[model samples]
Target chain A: MLAKPGLLVLGLALGLSTLLPSEAEAHRRWLLPSSTVLAGESDLVTVDAAASNGLFLFDHRPMALDSLVITGPDGAPVDPTILGAGAYRSMFDVPLRAQGTYRIALVSDGVMGSYELNGERHRFRGSGDALPAGATNISSSRSNSRTETFVTLGAPTDTALQPTGSGLEMIPVTHPNDIVAGEPAVMCFLLDGQPAADLEVEFVAGGTRYRDEPGIVMLRTDAEGRVTLQPSEAGMYYLEVSSSQDAANGQPGRRASYTAVLEFLPL
Target chain B: MRVSIAFAFAATGLAAAPSAAQEMAISVEIPRLKVAEYHRPYVAVWIEDAAGKSVRTLDVWYDVDLKPEDGAKWLPDMRTWWRRAGRSMTMPANGVTAPTKAPGTHSRTYRQGSRPLANLPAGSYNLQVEAAREVGGRELVTVPFQWPPKALTSASARGKSELGAVRLTTKR
Candidate 1:
């Protein structure tokens, strides 16, 4: 019953998400919490987020948060103010007042692209125009990234740690807020509440500013839709799962893309 | 206040538990694949508590059938279980660890009040199965189940590439 509050806020937040402006295709957004595991109730936690076109490089502009929903230990919404912003990232801090898990969800609007197929530029977007002889094709619209992270203070509880029931979702088998370094963290990906099988998940070591493309460990879920990753060190870890499907109508090359980013630390 | 309240609810749920004289079985299948290079997947199956601590290891299928038995060297590739319990275990571990399984359904059944089900307290647990191949992909699947069946507890999950369907059935 406690998960209802977070789910309620999430439902409202997702309903509002559709009206926002779409971001660029290459811009992958991520939310990074300052401390994944807080020691006590009075402790404060900060989160820095950005949309990056380059891999693991925070060089792109920070995304405007149309709806920033922070569900706290009791499943009530916790609002956070934008403390600062740079060209590539924005920062916010919140005081931890409860003893359970905290969930930060950022849902942006879907992006639409209509490019004229000049040569070999045929991609997902198409405008239902008749294809000329040896002409380039068009692409339709694509969904923006939905980013989320879990932060725990003092103890772990079943707050918003489960799947959010829409788009790209990560349901933790072993609770994400209570993970330990060197221990295997298990989770499953669900696309619209159903098990997403053979989904490719990219796990990257975090905390690097922007020098090199971080080493990526590629993993695919089993038939039952699960992937396991053991955190090597105690720093930041990024788990990204994304999928794209061709338009069911099978015409102007419409494609729907879904991405979910989860940032946490192994304690 | 919230933590204690939640803990009390969990304890009360466990206290109203059923007897543990039921039969349980785990069915794990390794899917056959066609690739340029194929090797038998080294699988590790274990149970963990809600806190993610390994409670018992059901089976570890490595290179037991090989001549040199050097297959144990690659068990670390099943990184999740190796970090949790495999490192503490000795090689040629009898009764629990076996050889690489072929591409088929393998069922492991423990009788009532066995070493695993007997020691498991009435609580929430996750049965995790991980498989890693030499040149292929690595996959893990978890089946969440509650001990002392809330009602004939049965859960199943499917993997895509390396593993088939994983099912855990408990009969009261």
Candidate 2:
């Protein structure tokens, strides 16, 4: 009984360290699409993505090109043509032809941000990318970004919107493409094909350009792993959901976070 | 464990089941918009919980009283309510359904618990009013109110184009 209390206390202390505000402020890599949904086949979609300490504040630090992975509505890989890259922002375009949800994910390579511990050099990574064999002496971290948005041509089909067992994905019980602004849309989330309950899924009102703390509404899934949300705005509704787990392989002080952004259009 | 689970389910069922005295009174306003192609907007009034689940629908105003009584065809234009509750309902829902109202405040009270509100559980809810018009913009306004209030509680919200000031009040 005494050992259990000690273990619980230690567990909580470790949890608090991971939730420190500074680390969260440091790694905010998001992909902001011009429109999550395209009205037709001829519609073109543009995205502005970067890795910065601020949200939507372009500081010219573009994400590593190799880290990006784009999937079309049919689950086939689609490549986005890079339009321009400046010091603080990178722009890309995906000519949406298929009429289904497209998912863009970024698994960045480790960025070295080192610190000292106990009079010795200690490196702890934020993202879960494993360090190279000889680079264990340096603390390394990588940020993983996963976002899902749809492009509809004629009529939407279920094939592309279905869950592909991505890290953290939401399968809209109501059709994702057919969401109306005022109606409640139910979505079931899966973390590797199993129901994930009690996760805090935040729904932010879209069209608030450059406002960091514009009101955020949060919903938690019930025991059945479902959340119902009414989109308040008529623009691109961005849902930011993330979860973190301790690193495997007996790595004592490593945490790996999996973050997902679902960009929905409520008309 | 089995008994507790069964009891929990039973409790939920009871809380959601409408009792004898519960009542809901809604007041909807239609603002006369001055436009060239002016048409009465099709309005839908419904109640949804914080989770966005439709608990009950109070009223839906469409072109129900058209020349050939063909206004039911355009009921689908009120997309949100049409998808949730409109499709299942038979046209001209007797005492509950009505034609589009003129620019004025209209009040309706469900004396006996209606189909949707009959099984409403006590929780935070939003009174959603959606209006879509022909040749005009669509507007939606939601007013948040609590159920089973200690006393009468009311809330109001305003809409921009197709909708007017929406006021919702509930009495236990």
Scored by DockQ, the top model is 2
Top lDDT prediction, candidate number: 1
Quote each prediction's TM-score: 0.48, 0.47
RMSD of 1: 19.9
Q: Let me know the DockQ for model 1.
A: 0.02
Query: If you assessed candidate 2 against the hidden native complex, which CAPRI class would it receive?
Result: incorrect
Flag clash pairs in model 2.
A59-A88, A60-A87, A60-A88, A123-A139, A125-A140, A127-A142
lDDT of each: 0.67, 0.61
Candidate 2: list runs displaced more than 4 Å: A1-28, A39-41, A51-65, A107-144, A207-213, A247-267, B1-172
Per-prediction tally of clashes? 16, 6
- Candidate 1 regions exceeding 4 Å error are A1-23, A53-57, A109-144, A207-213, A250-267, B1-172
- Model 2 chain B poorest ten-residue lDDT run: B13-22
lDDT of 2 by residue, B1-172 (tens): 5346335545655433444345667777788878887888888888888988777777778877676535765565565666556655666766557778888887876532344455566788888888888787777798988777556777788887676778776666
A127, model 1: CA deviation in Å? 15
